[model samples]
Target chain A: MVAHPTRDRRAERREATRAEILDAAWELARIHGLAGISLREVARRIGIQPPTLYWYFDSKNAIYDAMFAEANRQLLQLIAEQEWPTEPREMLRMAARVWVAFSTEDVARYQLMFQRSIPDFEPSPEAYAVALEILQTMRVDFAAAGISDPAHLDLWTAVVAGLAAQQTSNQPGGDRWLRLTDEAADMFADHVLGTTTQESQR
Target chain B: MVAHPTRDRRAERREATRAEILDAAWELARIHGLAGISLREVARRIGIQPPTLYWYFDSKNAIYDAMFAEANRQLLQLIAEQEWPTEPREMLRMAARVWVAFSTEDVARYQLMFQRSIPDFEPSPEAYAVALEILQTMRVDFAAAGISDPAHLDLWTAVVAGLAAQQTSNQPGGDRWLRLTDEAADMFADHVLGTTTQESQR
Candidate 1:
């Protein structure tokens, strides 16, 4: 049942070409948005005849699926690397800083994950699982930091998500926005760690 | 030097026509992303020839400007009517609820404010003034609630804007997202008002 050597080489080459096309499409979408892109345009960018694109991927959605999955995977990896703090307030602060820094540093990648319009598109189960894993990690981290109420984890995630979205849009008052978010993270942490009274008195 | 009566009447009608066109365009942009719309399509929806649209508004940008102004005006009016809470935490919670409800109810209008793409479009001075006034009111309210840091006001605005953007897009984890937002608001309020410690201990 071993594959022929020529067939294996051809498959590897095709896979490499598909990856190249997807990478180009991802860059184009970041600048022009998902709605304005087309298969012909993607092929042109990849220096291939438009019809040749079909040989590697079925449709634009498939390429998007690949790019989206890659972007989400990268983000989840970044989140996983954050150091969870021993203090509740510090823990939330670290998470907030990491989230904001990741979004601001990689604007195009961040938009693909959160901001684009793709109607009637469902993520592959693997992509969804990766996204969920990131969220779950944050929840476990919060609990370990002494956040007794499971509900607070959800709120923190939303706040963090919201902060990322605002920061990436180049919205007005950007610095102030981040500062406020840091303060919020601090507050949430203190509440979780039962240090609010001491912190408040200061 | 008085204008002719007919001239004045024509001018009044022109203003009314422009307003009507803007209203229609705003609704249309909501269903179709701003980039997906065209002046011709908007005119057709309003029962007019495409060229006739230019008689009142010069371009889609002009129409968008008008619609943006109107939406901001409505938001300001809504915020103005709400009584300010004396406690900082309460104030944030109240603001969060109002902001979320406004977005959830008039999603199209909300998206027009925060998510629309406007290349090289500087908001008109009048629009800027209106937006400034809205932020000023929030700042004053925050000050009154003893949350004197100007940065916190900006963060609250970003969080609210972020939440609105998420809700408008119909992102996954609907109920969970909302509940998380509510908790974030409460935690933010406690932090700002120096109440988190006292409340959590109780």
Candidate 2:
């Protein structure tokens, strides 16, 4: 059966409105800390009644889920689009830099994804899948480097993400942690990765 | 000069009250997220009106500052009370475990010191000095370990703090990162610390 033209046009309009609301929420979240934004303020910014927002979003948590999913989608695209180096160490180094850069780019998004900023909020399964996909990408990279152990994966994430956390928390746009990114990548590649079968193979 | 008996008694009472207020605030912070507590709630818990709280803490951020200072003092004490291994690598392994344990033990304190949870809340110079003192102790340990460069210090902080963060945020009470603490400490000792002169001295 052919889709009805009016129904399709109406669907497009609904999608456009949802996108507009999300954009406004993110803009406010950037200024206020991630937990600072409220549904009322988001609605006021977009000149919509709060109830109208409820029509699109079940609650503030739903909006958070959408935003989280969107952030991951952007990250997935960023990773896919980058020209990665072939050498395993170089690639991990590049990955570490990108991970920190992505996190620091928006403090709010970084908090939402990495931090339990919102009380009583858990990402919906569909939204969480996006996050899982991002983790999967990292796992694949680790596998490529001949490191498949979950413990190693956990340690690498802790090291890489820890630098980003320090950079964003202590000194944004500063070289304190950012300068060490390359050095750190080298350290992990030499120190941590050496324990892995990958470097042992070399 | 020797203090008068009356003045000494009054000073003791004041200090006692201040400690009581701070304790109540921390109890509430643990229940709510670190940033979630209000002065009113703290006052109510301690059976005082909110205005009375101002006698001890000038404002909410002042309370946060006190809390931050208290947390660091505890850290300083914790470090001092422990007997450290003489072996450089063993000391680092112990240090890594202690750091993660300290951080996860009190999530509220961790957020205040490291995560930047409170908006517009900068720790007062006095409170921050305590923090600096804590860092200075870490520096002394690093020096003893023969890892004197600021780069090594930065990397070490990232790795230790990063694991604490993952443990608290992703898997509190689970050993995903905690279990790797020994192995990670070894990795740092072998790779990063081995590059230092202290390890060579061994």
Candidate 3:
């Protein structure tokens, strides 16, 4: 098939507009609560008529789905970019640090991706697949440490996310909870890895 | 001061109205997101003019504060009412069950109490004091298990809150995360208490 230059340019522009709409929605979410996003307001901010906004996103929930996928992709990129250590325990700790930093930096994004703050917004399957991929990536890290139980993965997520939630919720712009990241990862890691004797001293 | 029966009756009615307003707000939150609540909508629900709502709550955030305090008080009551096991480890596990149940039962309440979902809503000092008291009560439990380190308490909270967050966010009305409550609690418990050999086998 021959490449159509004009159609390619048009598609590029459309994709850019979608990104703009998503960025504007995130800005509104930061100001209003996540669920507080109004489509009319979003349209107004992006200099589009309220009805015209539908061309890009059919509904507010559609916008949410895009944002969900975008956030997860950023997470995927972050994980991919890290020079992950070969030592499994160190890798787990590094993952915790990366997640906490990512979550606390943009609380609105964190709530959207992790916290179910939006009442009716469930990520579309395509978007949710990205989240599952992130989990699978972490699963391999846990498996490397000889912690193969699925329950431990659930526990690992709870611990690290709890740290992020605490940091974002209680001590925003502070490290009270963020500072606990390494220790928390080590604690859970040691617990599941059956190496508790040394860590118990802490 | 001398008791005034008529004044006391008037005060009782005023308090009753306040409770009614809070209940209405909670109803709205269940339907809408927690931060999606509106002062006007609340007034309409309870058959009062929007302006009249000021008598009970000076602002929407005030209603949120009242709700925050009320939610924590309920948590405090829930903890107080538990038939806490004398065995520290048993008590800890029991506490996890209670918390995850309390949290997943009503996600709106959990978000208000635990999650900073409402961007600008900060609980009043009195309300936060109740939250702190809940933490202090749990501290006694950790202390009983000979886990005197405060970091352990933070880890325990992260672990448990993570479970609640997981249950409420990922598997609402499902036991996927809820079923992990005892194991999650025990993982952290044994990690801090130095009893990992038995649990790691799982």
**lDDT assessment of candidate 2:** 0.85
Clashing pairs in 1: A89-A189, A155-B180, B89-B189
What does the interface RMSD come to for each candidate? 2.7, 1.0, 1.6
What docking grade does candidate 1 earn? acceptable
> What is the Cα root-mean-square deviation between model 2 and the actual structure?
2.8
* Best candidate according to DockQ: 2
Model 1: residues >4 Å from true position, as ranges? A1-7, A38-40, A82-89, A146-150, A171-176, A179-181, A196-202, B1-7, B86-89, B116-122, B170-183, B196-202
Question: Each prediction's TM-score against the native?
Answer: 0.84, 0.92, 0.86
Model 1: how far residue B100 lies from native, Å: 2.3
Cα displacement (Å) at residue B176, model 2: 1.3
Q: How many residue pairs clash in each candidate?
A: 3, 0, 0
Highest-scoring model, TM-score:
2
lDDT of 3 by residue, A1-202 (tens): 9765656887888999998899889998888867778888888998998898889888889999999999999999999999988766787889889998999899889989988877778899999999999988878876876678887788888888888877777777888888889988888777776675447535
> How well is each residue in A78-106 modelled by candidate 2, as lDDT tens digits?
99899887678888888988988898888
- Tell me the docking grade of candidate 2: medium
Q: What DockQ results for candidate 3?
A: 0.58
What does the lDDT read for residue B187 in candidate 1?
64
| Candidates, DockQ | 0.45, 0.74, 0.58
- The TM-score obtained for chain B by all candidates, in the order given, is 0.83, 0.92, 0.92
| Candidate ordering by DockQ (highest first) | 2, 3, 1
Q: Comparing candidate 1 with candidate 2, which one achieves the higher lDDT? A: 2
